[model samples]
Target: MSRLPAVFATGLILALAGGAAAVQRLPATPEPARLTGWPQPAEMPGFGDDGTLGPAEISDLTEYVLALAGAQRDEAAVIRAVPLYQTHCAACHGLGGEGAEILGTPDLTRRQFRVVTGPADIRLQIWHGDDGRGPMREAQRRSGRPHG
Candidate 1:
């Protein structure tokens, strides 16, 4: 009886862990999360140029600040982002969307192009250094420039 109970408990634990892993594997959704009394960027200087910046620039700028998970330009997200990249990012990333390894460009091919796993991590990176210079530097650099 003791052996049976121990085996049952182990199986239950394994099942739960598998379920948790499946949950983690699910596609990530990006949305603006609100915080209490956070100051507005609009009110600050050196931002919001009253439409002086081009639309593509606006998109890149937004992507830079959003700090969301799976921030890559996926099929779902690409529908909205490709036009933006074509106008702004293509020059650096290239016509095939292959980022410039020669000039430290980032490949936005996957959900993990850069891991922002949480708000705190993303904030620290944005304010400080991103493994080196730009966002997703570690992931992109380490991956050996795979498609993304």
Candidate 2:
């Protein structure tokens, strides 16, 4: 009976030790880099006959824009969107979201937009340009570029 107890304890210890070793050997999940500024991409998405921005990218960019307009910021999403804004919007909206009068793009840094009232409105603008300019969606579909 005493021998049985010793065997059970030994088996428990061995099982625990084996589990610890297995845990040590397991691969760790990679952590995303700590981004202090915007992330830059090697290649920008092309405004080809098909729209370049994906659904996720548009969501991230919208969140980032809201942050720029003084809304609650999603730091991670904002960082991810920095390069996207530079490549896609900066040409007309300017780096600071100052916007261009000639291009008829509205200033994004302001809290109140002439056309955009909320997130959906911003997404609509991204998909379709403002009234002064031709619809970005149709232009991208037809010519692979925004028609200012």
CA RMSD, predictions in order: 19.1, 14.6
- Model 2 segments beyond 4 Å from truth? 1-49, 131-148
Q: Which regions in candidate 1 have their CA more than 4 angstroms from the true location?
A: 1-77, 110-115, 118-132, 135-148
lDDT of each: 0.44, 0.65
Model 2 scores a TM of: 0.52
lDDT string for model 2 (1-148, tens) is 4699899999999999999999998669856554444343212223322467776677778887788788887889899999989988897678988876544456778853654557765654555445443334343456444321
Alpha-carbon shift of residue 60 in model 1 (angstroms): 8.9
- Candidate 1 lDDT, 43-111, residue by residue in tens: 111111333344344444345434122444334434554465465446655654456554444453432
Best by TM-score: 2
Error of 2 at 112 (Å): 5.2
